[model samples]
Each structure stands twice: as structure tokens, then as C-alpha cells.
Target chain A: MRAVDTGGYLKGRIRREDIISAAAVVYGEVGYHGASLREIAKRVGMSHAGLLYYFPTKEALLAAVLERRDAEDAEREQLDSPPGLEVLRHYLALASHNVRHPGIVDLYARLAAEAVAPDHPAHEYFKRHYDEARVGVRDSFRVLAESGELRAGVDPEQATITFIALMDGLQVQWLTTPDAVDLVGSLRFYLQALLTVPL
Target chain B: MRAVDTGGYLKGRIRREDIISAAAVVYGEVGYHGASLREIAKRVGMSHAGLLYYFPTKEALLAAVLERRDAEDAEREQLDSPPGLEVLRHYLALASHNVRHPGIVDLYARLAAEAVAPDHPAHEYFKRHYDEARVGVRDSFRVLAESGELRAGVDPEQATITFIALMDGLQVQWLTTPDAVDLVGSLRFYLQALLTVPL
Candidate 1:
């Protein structure tokens, strides 16, 4: 019988996470196209070949970075498990959470923009990302509507679209002029206007 | 009196506009960093040197491109001249106008995302651009508030921020999935919710 190298496995996982973190910073600073593997490896004190051993290509590395971001967001917010109004409270909390991590927010903003092109590598990724995002938000709003919690004449689908849009647009303005925006507060204000009950 | 070369001057103006249009297309396709001057020049069927003769540098060309977008928007919407509710109406109209021209909207979205970096070439340009935009929208909302046309408990400054954020955010979603989003309709829905009167 062979013994499992549990310690080594843990080390490898930690090193991989470190690589993803460095890649996020580089991708945030210079975008996906402009980011170089050599630069990302150097940031982590790894050789290009060593980094490739973990992530074979730039696209692979990008996928890891994005996946990690989503995992972290999902775990922290527990956004998927919550239902109806709870989902929205968690979302607002996520905004507050994002304010403290400008690096990830900046990376997301840059990548989402670059992915608008149909041929771009992240295009499909973003398309699916938004789709899942909308569905989750829509389902929650629908629950609210069923209970008569949503205001009169506020369609759940439309409210979902507007809510998502407001989050995205506020990120741009807040990123450009951080002091000028109240990210969480503005979101709360919009929600207050949309819902009949209190948050 | 010496004869004026009016024909030559008109031809120069036409060529300049052609270059700007081509640049917009290229910039919209690839972001500012990824876009090349040679490619833009090639699209216009002009030599690199000839293009430089018109605009001195890449930054200069970018500035011209952004300035031209704003100029055309102001002229078409008369957004700056209107007061109170009319200003919001024109902004909504501008969104409708934008749906017919996805290329420009794509360019603005990409650049706005890229320009989030403090050192980006268009950083200051976007900073001032958003500042002026917020002020224009804010003043109009303030006027509505003063006249009691705004919904109760809605603050003009906060509404201005949310409105701008919604527009910017909706653009990202719309660009990603044009069919899934109702850009102009969403804006109208938000305005309807915020105001005591109809949009």
C-alpha cells in the first residue's frame, strides 16, 4: 500500500492560490491582454516554466483567477443558498465587501469591458456569468413579488435588470472617484424605493 | 482679394472625420491599449505619417475621439440646455439613440473600464467627464426636488448617483447580451419610480 502525500498536496494547493492572487493583481493593473505570464510569475518569485506547470496557458490562468473570485464571493456571501429578500441583503453586503477589495473590483471591471468583443477569450465567460447572475437575482425578486413585498408596478424581471445595472454602473463611478460615491448606501436607497417592506 | 482654398479646407475636414470614425470602430473592437495607430490609419486608407499629421499622438487621437463623442451627444440630445425633467428625458432619449449605435457604446464601456486605472491615459478625461455628468444630472434632479416633482424621501444627490450608475451598469449588460436587455425601457422604468410624474 502507498501512503498519500497529504502535506505535499496542501503545499501545491497553497502555491496555486498564490499564483492566482498574483495573476489577479497583474490582470487588474494591465488587463488580460496586456498581462504577461513572466510578469505574473516574477511577482510570485516563480520561474515562467514553474508557473506553466500550474497553469499551462494565459487563458487557463485567467479562468483560475475568475473561478477563484466567484468561489470566494459565493462562500463569503452564501448568496446562492439565500432566498427572496435575504438574497438582496447579501448582495448589498457584497457591495460593502467589495469596497474593501478594490483590486478584485478593478480586475472585474477591466475584464468585463474587454470581454465585450465576441472574439475575446472571456466573452463567453462573461455572457454566462451575467446570465447566471440575472437568473439568481430574478428568482429572488420573483419570490419577493409573490409575497407582495415588491412595490406596485415593479416587475421582478425589470427590477432585477435595473438592480444589476445599478451595481455595475456604480462600480465605474466609484472606481473613478471613490469619495464621490456611496456604493452601499445608494444600493440601499434603490432597494428601499423598490420594496414595500423594510430591509 | 486673394482667392481662398475652400475646396481644400472642406476636403481636409472630411478626411479628418473619416479618420475619427475609423478610430472609433477600431477602439470599440480593441480597447485603447490593444488598439494600434497603424490599424486605425489602415482602416482609413491613410499612411501612418499622414494620420500623425492630423493628430500628433495616440493620446491626442484618443482625446479627439472622446471629445467628438461628447460633442455629437450634446448637439443631438441638447442635454445641457434642458432643465429639470426635460434633462432626464433627453438622457433617456440618448440611451435610445445609443441602442442604435452599439459600436460607440462599446467603445465608451471599454474605455471607461480601462480608464479606471489612475495612470491610464484617459484617466483624467473620464474623471472630469463623470464629474460633469453627475453635476448636470444632479442639478436637474435638484430642480425637480425643489418643485416637489420628485417622489417623497428621494434625495436628488443620491438619485443622481443611482441614475448614473444604472445607465452605466445597464450598458455593460446590454453590450454583453443585447437581446436580453431593454436599455431604454429600463431607464424609463427607473425614472418612473423616482418621479411623481411620468417620463
Candidate 2:
């Protein structure tokens, strides 16, 4: 039941989490417009109304799906973060993990892209995510900067935004064309550049 | 009839291009799946099937839309890109331009996101885009390195991907929330840090 299962154990739980996971996969494979509630119900071996019984509306279902994805990301955020060079190494690991099962990253970013629509149900979720994430990143960045791990004068908030942008952008290229994405290597180099400064 | 012209002018000229522009707007405003060919055609004072006559299908239409946006980008590419701070400055200008028409940025990125599906019509376009873009960036970095404007030990290809990735990442934020994007200012800061050691 741990959402943080390492080898991708999110596939086989019978709880609401299972349904949410199935929803993410189905929704990701097809887009929000193309994804059908009935299809998602079918994949989970339930009737359409039955699935609706639990989640209520298509909007609620999509919200739950995004919430689950965010939960997974949030869980990863709690892992013991490495320090100094290890932080860069951890980023490389993160890149490799994302490349291997790209659907996760795709789903996250696709939601963000679609969130721009005025009526997108995920709008509030994305806005909150960005706001809260900016705060958290600023805090962590301050820690790293104070420890001399980060280059001087790097605005934590701006750096956070830029970092998120890089992750989303790189995933766009990688998922669309893996060959163009060096995954771990390109990020490793960038991180090296970022961390390099007069020590 | 430029695809991204946000200012008012020539609204009724060149019916075909106007239709594409409408589709671009709809796609950007409501996202790909949320947009309707009917809405686009309506904006252009045409019927749905009538609009299809010019572009054939929505997929082809989306491709053309992306192509038109890239045309502007290609124009920017034609400029003699100066190295060091100049490259960053021009890059910021590109960001400012995209910010003016966030919808164009949205439309371009949505196509890239959808291209991950094996059957997406835009698959080849996104793939070719990344490949050629990577090569183009590498060549540019090579020029900078040769002219003694690049830091020693910087890999042009890695730098290329990183720059492109950062552009994409920052672009998402910029498009979603333009006020938050300090394109030129922050980019200048990053480049100043990055270009510390020249050639």
C-alpha cells in the first residue's frame, strides 16, 4: 500500500489506490478528451456506473487521478535527499527513473499543459501545486545554498521554477523521442555545471 | 496572416491562413482535445467540413499550425546569433515574443506532448524537430567554443540539450504565468554564471 514502492509496485493494489493507478494509466494512454470513464471502468473490470459510484463524476475521477500522481511525487519528495555531489547523483537517478516509465512524467506534465484552459478541472490543483512547490523548493534551496552546495546568489524560487521547467521540458523531448534525451547523462552534466563555482 | 499575430490587423485577409490562425487560437485556449474544428471554422466564418477542405483533417491542420509557429522560430534562427551575452539576450527576446502569444506556445507544446502516442500524426514532426534542433544547437555551441566564447570542458551537445531543456521548461512557466517570467533578466544571470570561463 506504500505509494513509494520502488520497483513500480503501484500496479497491483486492490484499494482505491489501485483504481486511481489504473485511471492514471488509461487516462495517460488516451488524453483527457480521448479518455473515457467507461473505458477506465472496463480496464478496472467494473461497470461505468460502478466506477462513477466511487468517484461520482468524471471531473472527480480526473481530479483523483491527478491527486494520486501528485501523491506519488510527494512521496518521492520525502525520500532521504542526498547532499553535495550526491544531490546531483540523485537527480541522475531521478532522470533514469522517469525515462524508464515515462507515463508518470507524461501524465504529470500533460495535466499541467491542459491546466491552462479556463474550465480545466485540474486548474486549482496545478496552481496550488506550483505555489506550494515554490515555497518548498525555496526552503530546500536555502539549506543547500547555506551549506555551500549551491552556487551563490541562486534565487531559490527562481531556481526551483527553472528546475521544474527543465524536468518538464526534458521529459517532453524524451517521451516524444528518447534518442534526443540523454536522460541521466545530460542532466548530470548540467548539474555539474550548476554546482561548479569557486569553492 | 502570421500564425501568432496578437495585435489587430488584416483580420479578414487570406482566408486560408486565417483559418489556421483560428485553429491555433482554439487549440491554445482550450487545449487540443478540448478544441473543436467547428469552433475554429466558426471563428473563420466557415463550416466544419469546409474548413477540412483546406487542411484535410485535424491532424494535418495541427501539423500546419505547428509548422507556422516554427516558421517564426526559424526566422529568429536566421539572425546572426551573437555569442556570450548576446545569445542569452536574443533568447530572452524569443521568450518575450512567445509570452505575447501564450497560445502559440501552448499549441506548439501540446503537439509535442501528443506526439508520444505512436499513432499521433505529429510524431515525425516532433522527432525531426528534436534531432535537427539538437544538431543546430550543437553547431551553435561549437561556434562559441571555437571563437573562445565557451567555457573550457563544456560539451556542446550537453550544453545544447540543457539550453533547449531550460528553454522548454521556462517556457511552460512563462506561458502559463507570463508575469512570473523574467526571461531576459534571469537568463542573463544564468548565462553569466555559465560563461564564466570562455574558450
Name the best candidate (by DockQ).
1
Candidate 2 per-residue lDDT, tens place, B1-199, comes to 5655733334434667888788877886777777878889899888888887777778877987887777767677442354344554566677667767776777676667767666778788778777767776677677777866776777877888877777776766665566666655555555554565421
lDDT of 2 by residue, A85-123 (tens): 444354456667777777667776666776655567777
Clash total of candidate 2: 2
Estimate, for each residue in B1-199, the C-alpha lDDT of model 1 and write its tens digit. Answer: 2236887788889999998888887877866667888999999999999998988778667867987998899889998975699999999999999999887787788778878878777888889888988999999999999998999899998999999999989998999988899999999999998888887
Q: Candidate 1 lDDT, tens digit per residue, A1-199? A: 1235887788889999999999988876867768999999999999999999998888768868987888889789988975699999999999999999887787788778877778777788888888888999999989999899998889888998999999888998999999899999999999999999999
Q: How many clashes show up per model?
A: 1, 2
Off by over 4 Å in 2: A1-15, A25-34, A42-47, A53-59, A73-89, A197-199, B1-18, B22-35, B39-50, B76-88, B176-181, B197-199
TM-score of each: 0.85, 0.79
